[model samples]
Target: MKWYKKWLLIIVAIFVMIPLFIGIIQHNKKLPSHISFEGPTYKTDELEFLYDLTYQKNEERVLEQQLLGTALEIINEAENFLVVDMFLYNDDYDRDKGEYPNSAQKITNALVEKRKDNPTMSITVLTDAVNTLYGSTNNPYFETLEDNNINVLITNVKPLRDSNPIYSSIWRPYLQWWQPSQEGFLPNAFNPDGRKGSIGSYLDLINFKANHRKIILNESRAMLTSANLTHDGSSYHSNIGFVVQGDILKDIYLSEQAVANMTGYTLPDVTFKSSNETNGELEIQLVTEGKIKKALLGALAEADEQSTIKIGVFYISDRQIVKGIKEAAKRGANVQMILDPNKDAFGIEKNGIPNRQVAAELVPNKNIEVRFYDTNGEQFHSKFVIVTDEDETTLIGGSANFTRRNLADYNLESNLVINMPKTHVLTKEINDYFDRMWNNDDGQFTVEFEKYEDQTLWKKAFYRLQEFTGLSTF
Candidate 1:
């Protein structure tokens, strides 16, 4: 063969083999079954439900968000061990924002102090590599934790299914092997012009999967939330969480240990088992990843003429669940959704895509009501579903967004499925929360679909494309 022709053939072979290699690894990636544990649920008096609505009113910002505060409290009060798996745990906001409240740093400080107080205590923080921009840069906050003898587990994405296969195909064979050089050359993906990343970091940005669970497991209690410890995320975003003190904490610990094991972290021989003792009247189930989708589908299938389903979520792009919801509305179940408009991220403004389009799809059904979560400057970053029947009420909530990447087992997500008596205090409180937001009581929690409805054909196509292809940030 001619020398030039041989070189061209080599390049073509490289392109072809890379994708095949990625496909092989992605197909063979091992993932355990989604953990589900059902135990006695606690009532309102037995457990605390922490919720805060961060908003702007009268030209002033009201940051009532308290999920991070509760997480910090749990860490400070932990006596033996502290395990946290957070999706985002870095200070990566745009510098133009002018130094936001550094929540991640504060949490790190608390952990460091706790270690100092009791040098034998164990602290492990598991977080996504996105905080470090796919290992392109170093996170000072995480480094500080490690400096204090805390164990930091950055999730190994190699075992995760490729969400954006096009990028993963190229990234796997060539760039995946490149060492993450701290010798900065490229601008930081999170905050450009502040800190630079290595070439490998830029390459890894193409793979858009994450360990998105926001869980804090301590000896006495456990919390599952939709809030991140990132400085930018803490102040301006509205979030929600559940803090339970029961046998469920042990279940949470085991589930978190599974995540640690995935990244090759050998947790101490911790004896964690559900005590099987009753905490209160509410019955709880810990559902993760694909199990959550199954529970959601089953609950939607149960909706009937007399049932009402209310959802407030950050994103909703899962087709099976969406279709089930539509079917429920068609069957005379009252269905309502207050979804984020997908309008802003950090300092970037976005056009409403998935939420608006989803709203438009259900608008034609009289039994369905769709509204946009009213926001001042930040996103309504909560993911929850409440279903009420004549006798029983069910609430599913946690860090999982209703999107393909979030539900299809591509991301490490955890949620709680609670079935309680219709008249139970916890049930009443969740119902009241929906009612307050729906009625615009006290603050403007939501606006009618007409306020920000975007049914543009192009956007519908775009949302579907991203949701289907997994080339999205949701």
Candidate 2:
């Protein structure tokens, strides 16, 4: 070979090998101590389940939203301090599609009003960087909060492990050095009419890691939910939330503190008073990151022939979870799943990649039943599983979805596990909620599995590849 050709070959190999080495090192490096946290199980009687529903009743779109109403109430009642760590907090949606409730603006107004009413109170809002398109633009809601003397902290997701390492490894070593600027000429990835994003921001977005926790807490109570403050062009998406008071508030506070600490911010010193009341029949535990997966698998493992497992989630592409559900069904446990059809993004249509393919895999079993949430331009975004045994029931729900990115420590996630006797009021309420949707008691909430079942061989292969490689968004 010619000398110049040999030198060029060497340069190509060096460039290729560098990113490969970085990817492996970053993937296996020791994570922050607080990443996959499992808080102590606390027994308390101050748990309330809140949900939002958007269903079709007699061809009319009916909306019954209780989650955000309670969240606003919590903000209003907090006198001393308020901490909100939401994954999405923006109103950058396609207005041509539909009219959303302006949830992001509502949340901002509530916080600003509270701050004005209690001038001395400490208010901090922590949110993912996606609201600003990874710092390529300024979010008006955050700006309003900051201007009102409230602290707005954009979570630094760089410290979190990269979910899409195939792209991030190269970006981290080659492109991450350039900080994304607020001014840009490129069109916005989320909304074309919105502010443009810089090339650096787009590069950073390809890393595909986020602090995907949705939590709101004060000095006294905490709430964890699957709802984002932002509507994302779909205001009527279904979601679930839990509000609790007791020592569990401290656990939620500490978990948020970890994120603040990782991002080099110090949360104000506040104490959560323990309830002196008697322990209720329910037991609650807080789990974050990978620990959510551990708790979920543990609950599934306890199922028996006499048990019933019901899952309603936005996404379900995690292999272990899929396998666990199959195993439980094989053990004679009745398993039913309600999943989104994966057919709607902001306003754009989506190929039913993961959920439809996943449902196709599970429905082949005689014991496993699956249904698609009947969506009309909105998604069914609830992420919860209920396992009912003969004497007790276990419920797991919160921000984490049953997907590799959300549950495998790649994205920061939080969830709560509740255990109670079968006769408990909360247990009955949850069971009734599931039955209402599953059976379409009062509305057309769900449809037969055949409505969106796809057995396409290539799509199944694509789903597996995307789930494993983190190449596509869940």
Candidate 3:
């Protein structure tokens, strides 16, 4: 080959290896220490944290009695307007058909019912087009609203229509790339479900994430929830939801509205109906960290002043988070962790980070308290943080995680810092559950949920080689 071609191949090889090298190096770095959050604080109390824990527990938190659904109810009853952005939305009863019952249907039904009762009320449902479970009934939940003239906007929507991932990613990519002028590619890429895409628009479905999940319901209520509006997420599987009551709710809702407009979808020119901007003595701020590592790390650094730190998350691998907790513990903060040890939560033992060796090293810290729970049958997926101030005010939950992606802006995540006058009973309940599991010798000791009892000889051999190779990044 010519020198230029040889150099070109070398460049590509280096580029490919660079990402792998970075990933491995970061993975091998020592975890950070615990620290308290003493930075600027949000003293708003109206916002509270709610999680729908996996069914693994006999009882942790349920949808019927939880604050998340009630908050949605309040938004539906809004006299001003209701706005919701979610990946999953239900127009039918999913759980009755052997699906798990969650928040989507009950909330959607409530909105539909509310719209009927109050014809003049304005409501908008904005969803990621990819998540619409359009079926034989035609997304009745959305249709019912649309037929009634309720505005609905579907997002990250390509023109293509197909239920198969292979069809969308593989076959579609090849055909569209090779036949740029093909009629099907453009139509299929932009006109998913035949409801979107201009007649002549041309584009393929790329962008793996176009707005994973977001919901801003009305001016009075807003949520940065991890649960999609699906049966498994809401009723069947474990999930987490956070509701905002003060000005932040309105601020977030409007911001999401702006995102909707910028992305080429239209919605009513909506603004916040009046809400109390002055939320009592608690300091509050809306923290949205998505891949801007430095910005999110700063937020975590500020949160290191609390004496008691309770962190709930779906994925926690942020070096800064580990550092924050460890430092806070060093600073005399009582750092206690309640984590889901089951690999399904973040994948498992050998295949994932909750590796026995890693967890063993992490738990040995004297100042930090770490407790892992079995989430085998259920999914223990909740991401929120509760910190207590000197005066004992409670900081509510949010979307930011102790992960590189959440804080470093690699991925967009939102977290709300609310100062409640007192820690709500619900927060105490969650903390208590953590305590119960942490204190007990075993929730069900027989089963070490986080550990892997089965591993092939090849996998073990590979890991041994990894250990010996000093390939700490692996």
My TM-score estimates for the predictions, one after another, are 0.92, 0.97, 0.64
Flag clash pairs in model 1: 41-282
TM-score of 1: 0.92
Error of 1 at 89 (Å): 1.1
lDDT of 3 by residue, 404-458 (tens): 4345432234555555444556546556655544555323312332443324555
Clashes of 2: 0
Better of 1 and 2 by lDDT: 2
Where does model 1 exceed 4 Å of error?
1-18, 24-29, 32-45, 56-59, 271-279
Give candidates' CA RMSD values in order.
Answer: 2.9, 1.4, 9.3
Q: What is the lDDT of residue 237 in candidate 2?
A: 88
The sequence of per-residue lDDT tens digits that candidate 2 reaches over residues 1-474 is 999999999999999999999998777677786788999988877899999898999999999888888888889889779999998888887778766778887888899999889998989888888889998998888889999999988888777777898998898789998889888889887786899899889888888889899998997778899998554464688999999998888888888988888888989899676688467788999999999999999998989799999999999999999999999998889999999999987777899989999999999986899999999988899999999999999999999999999988888899999999999999989999999999999999999999898999999999999999988777
| Position 151, candidate 2: lDDT | 90
Instruction: Rank candidates by TM-score, best first.
Output: 2, 1, 3
lDDT of 1 at 342: 86
Instruction: For residue 447, give model 1's deviation from the true position in Å.
Output: 1.4
